[model samples]
Target: MPDRVLVAYGTKNGSTAQIAEAVAEVLRKDGLDAEALPAGSVTAVEPYDAVVVGGGLYAGRWHKDARRFVRRHRRSLAGRPLWFFSSGPLDASASERDIPPVPGVRRAMTELDVIGHATFGGRLEEGAKGRMARMIVRSGRGGDFRDFTAVQAWADRVGQELTAAGRR
Candidate 1:
């Protein structure tokens, strides 16, 4: 709808990146031009009419890149639609339970007039993560808990919102 949409992500072990790509795909299918780029590559928000930022949650915190992106572009973001999502809750068994929002995310929402914020289950790869991440994954801390249906549903909602806003 906005002629261009940017889906930026900060991923650990690639799960969140995959999720960002999926969201971008769904947005494209909805007749919007969307691209999923790593947060580090995004120097500014000048090219997109809408922005969707996502990152994995670690120890109740979002990735640094994602946090920095929002902080750096807070002003630009305020003039446009912005959505945030965190990939966490790795315990698949806890999929049905209500996951709490990460503190950083909560603060971001309060400080910025974000349109929406969501928490999606994250993944824990066996050997892909760094020492700390792997240790956490191995210590029975998290599991592969992503729900595709829910992720797609959220993406669709974002697409609809962007479309409606474009019309206005």
Candidate 2:
């Protein structure tokens, strides 16, 4: 059970960060104390009663910053409720199974005893992408795929769990 929750995310062009913030907003609306922050900037997990880590997924890989943050704080996050999320795939109809969490996430999810994981639709802006990413976007795989409704619903579910679990 956790009252103070940290919704941390790693993003290259800010899509994942925006989703994280929205998740925090939902959690706050649910009467929980929560904060949205860039994963790379978060140095400690001690202050948080729970943590939600998210990142932009690309080519079956999670963001390096998000991965690093989890690895560095794995011990600190051993308990107290933890979850992971990723934003990728251009189609909302596509199951998360089509674009699964990377190997690193699989390992951390198991080792950390993560409560759950979600994969949401992602957005790709041409100018924001790097060389390789831009190439992919140029090939016509870019648009706003974020489903806010889905995000809110997922947040609400997590918030309910946190609420029921009660403050630690």
Candidate 3:
């Protein structure tokens, strides 16, 4: 049987959710059974052989929902092959270089024994919620910085790793 992988994400303006979906798509194309869903909606992680959790970065921290999900599913997640991703750079920095996880995410990785992590660019376009988001958009600083090509590449690696492990 193919490995069942869950790609769960915490997103505010929905860009991170899109990223998660793309990741899941790549996994499926690579022959794994993968699905993407909001982190909060997931009631259990025990049914999956692996998990990928992602969140939008906010003020040097992960989205609250992502943090809570990790805390809630820590035990089950710790035993599985896990990966994490954060998207929240409104600039080209992420595409140009490696951006380490924020302090909290780094700590979570240690506690969970996560297999890998990636930081992708973020999106903050017009109509985004929050006063700060609005202001940024008005200031002309809001736009999509996510690189779908990079997202696909990373997911392919994840799929390859998982598929190889499963064959053992």
Query: Which one wins on lDDT?
Result: 3
lDDT tens readout by residue for model 2, 1-168: 578999989898889999999999999999989999999999899999999999899778888889889988989889768988899778765343445567878788999999988888888877875887787689987887888888898899999999988844
Residue 52 local lDDT, model 2: 95
Candidate 1 residue lDDT tens string, 1-168 = 586999999887899999899999999998899999999889888889999999888777898888888888888888778888888776763357656557788888777778887788888867866888778767877567898788888899999998887788
Cα lDDT, model 1, residue 164: 88
Q: How do all models score by TM-score?
A: 0.91, 0.92, 0.98
Better of 2 and 3 by TM-score: 3
Selected candidate, larger lDDT, 1 vs 2: 2
| Model 3, span 37-151: residue lDDT tens | 9999999999999999999998899988899999999999999999999999999999999999999999999999999999999999999988988999999999999999999
Candidates ranked by TM-score:
3, 2, 1
TM for candidate 2 is 0.92
Candidate 3 pairs with clashing backbones: none
The residue pairs that clash in candidate 2, if any, are none
Per-candidate clashes, comma-separated: 1, 0, 0
Task: Check candidate 1 and list the clashing pairs.
Answer: 90-143
Find the candidate with the highest TM-score and give its number: 3
Q: Could you give me the TM-score of model 3 versus the true structure?
A: 0.98
